[model samples]
Target: MTLPLSGLAFPPSREPSTRVPADLRKQGFGVRIAEQRDLGFMRALYETLRAEEMARVAWPEGARQSFLDSQFTLQHRHFTTQFQHAEFLVLEHRGQAVGRLYLLRESPRWLVIDIGLLPAWQGRGIGGALLRQLQRDAQGSHAQGLALHVRLDNGRAHALYVRLGFREQGGVEGLHQRMHWDVPTAVAQLNTA
Candidate 1:
């Protein structure tokens, strides 16, 4: 199984698993702690997410796979080493793994390191539901807010973040824009309503 997106690798057997809440199940979604066993699935998913970008360069199959493998390894190592306390979560629709959500909990903010779904899983309201829940959790914990970066060309994701109340703070790196959704605003709206 190939994994989706570029992120940390968790050995399945060593970590405990968790089921989504009953409320989420009613929405046809589930969450579980990703396992080492899911690495293949995660890798495959990452490749799929990169397929379009890789196509632009049109590298030979061997070269493309090699490059992706190296980058994946580097990223996974960086994330795991840097954010030792982050949660490596697998997103499931119904019962099958469809995406991954990597979250880093810090003192006053929760960093959404990555959140990507398979092509087939996009635009199904799953991402929205998950983000809303994360927002709620942030508010509950009195965190500053949630923050994430999206590639400049990833219009779909950027739009979703905006619709979820994230404001574009500025650009990051070369081709990414940093966006933030403030928990205080969310709490204020809820209090007013």
Candidate 2:
């Protein structure tokens, strides 16, 4: 079932700055339901994510574009179809699309289907902030915890998850590994200690 936004402590809305500031990191970030018009930007963001890996492949320009296009299409279709109740949100900073976050609420635990930011927006703690907000939302709703799968090769993201208290669960699934953050247990441990 779809989780109602009214139940969560959603981010506050802010007026977009007229001129890009020197420190854009200080700007407030918010999220909104992604729309059809965002598909192009989202697709380009996906391409940026795979750029490094794609660079390693010695393929013609047209071939590379075609491959990314097909892969993105498949992924988008799969996510939309498989997680019908999930919220597909677009991360915005100063009213500009900076990233995307897909979340699915399954009674006991919330699943992070995907979360990614543009290269320019990375390393600014925005992703972590977004996750922290989600954690709070989950806790407020009395959910058990949050869960997600991280690519085996994504050490940076895996480290972030670990730092956020997510522990590796089960074995690897293909190229990804399952990880979970159990809120009740964590809270209990913290209380006891």
Candidate 3:
């Protein structure tokens, strides 16, 4: 598919629902969402996710493949109309897609199915900004909280979400842990940063 990596959903509002805060905004890497034809953008992003040598080595033999074959198949479908009812966002730098936030809504709770920032665009507060946007959307929908599952070995993602106020709720497959960040905590953390 064509890799149209520059379309950004500036939220359902006329302006950004909330700025990333001036201090943090300056730290913004200018990452935005990829458009409908950006499947090719995902090809490279997924490669980077799997290329984390240390994280890969820590996983059990079948861990990577199973996770990819299952969860990632859901993520890899981000560019399709299948996710039209939900929200899938991308973070771009200059003009290249650099990160993504995939969420699913099941009423009263917004499940953050996946979230990631490319290696090159990290450390710029984009992930946090995007997550806060998710937080806003969740609250506006009157959702109770946000949910996500991250493999135990994915220290990077775990740390980011935790700092964003997501706390462990349960574990699965002896690897991934389910997490949630409620509206109050989410807004507080985002504004604090």
Candidate 4:
């Protein structure tokens, strides 16, 4: 069930693909499958993602560094092994890599394993466009919705998900909140609109 790192297989779509919404394309936003050359960037971004949480632990500098290294390694291994078919995408805007998106398609749902953008790229519409595209993809399949896990302390990310129509399903592993964006409800609202 392992998908090649080049593209994703959507159930209803006839072909494997990578896409940038039309509007996003006009704004120079695009995405591509991550390759070996992108490893450093990916690891650095992962570190940046834990910066806030690492700061809150009150651990000494050496201990904090050790903790981040260990945690990052663990998380990386977990994702690669647990979701072998997931697509790892690199987000680019105006020809610069600004973020990453990891998606795993499971039975009855598409799991958004991780999505993170550099600080300068935050609040832009790239993440929203990527999500909307996923919802569109899900609607065409037997999938129920788009699901993701967001840390409870990441208010900005949590709010973004809420704004995008995801509701808290329940608590997941540790401090993560399991949220879902139901496609049928969204499509129904759109039709009504």
Q: How do the residues 50-169 of candidate 2 rate in per-residue lDDT, one tens digit apiece?
A: 888898999998888888877887788788778877778888887899998888888678899999999999888777777776776766665788999999988999999999999999
Question: Measured by TM-score, how close is model 1 to the native structure?
Answer: 0.83
Once fitted onto the true fold, the runs of candidate 2 whose alpha carbons sit more than 4 angstroms away are: 1-26, 186-193
lDDT of 1: 0.77
All candidates' lDDT scores? 0.77, 0.77, 0.62, 0.77
| Candidate 2 residue pairs in backbone clash | none
TM-score of each: 0.83, 0.82, 0.63, 0.81
Candidate 1: minimum summed lDDT over ten consecutive residues — where? 11-20
Whole-model alpha-carbon lDDT for candidate 4: 0.77
Per-model clash counts, in order, read 20, 0, 5, 0
Q: lDDT (0-100) at residue 109 of candidate 2?
A: 83
Q: Model 3 reaches what TM-score against the true structure?
A: 0.63
Candidate 1 local lDDT, 121-178, one digit each (tens): 8888777878888887777675788988898889989898999999988657687888
Tens digit per residue, CA lDDT, model 4, 29-80: 8887776666667767876888877777898877776766666567766877
Output the better candidate (2/3) by lDDT.
2
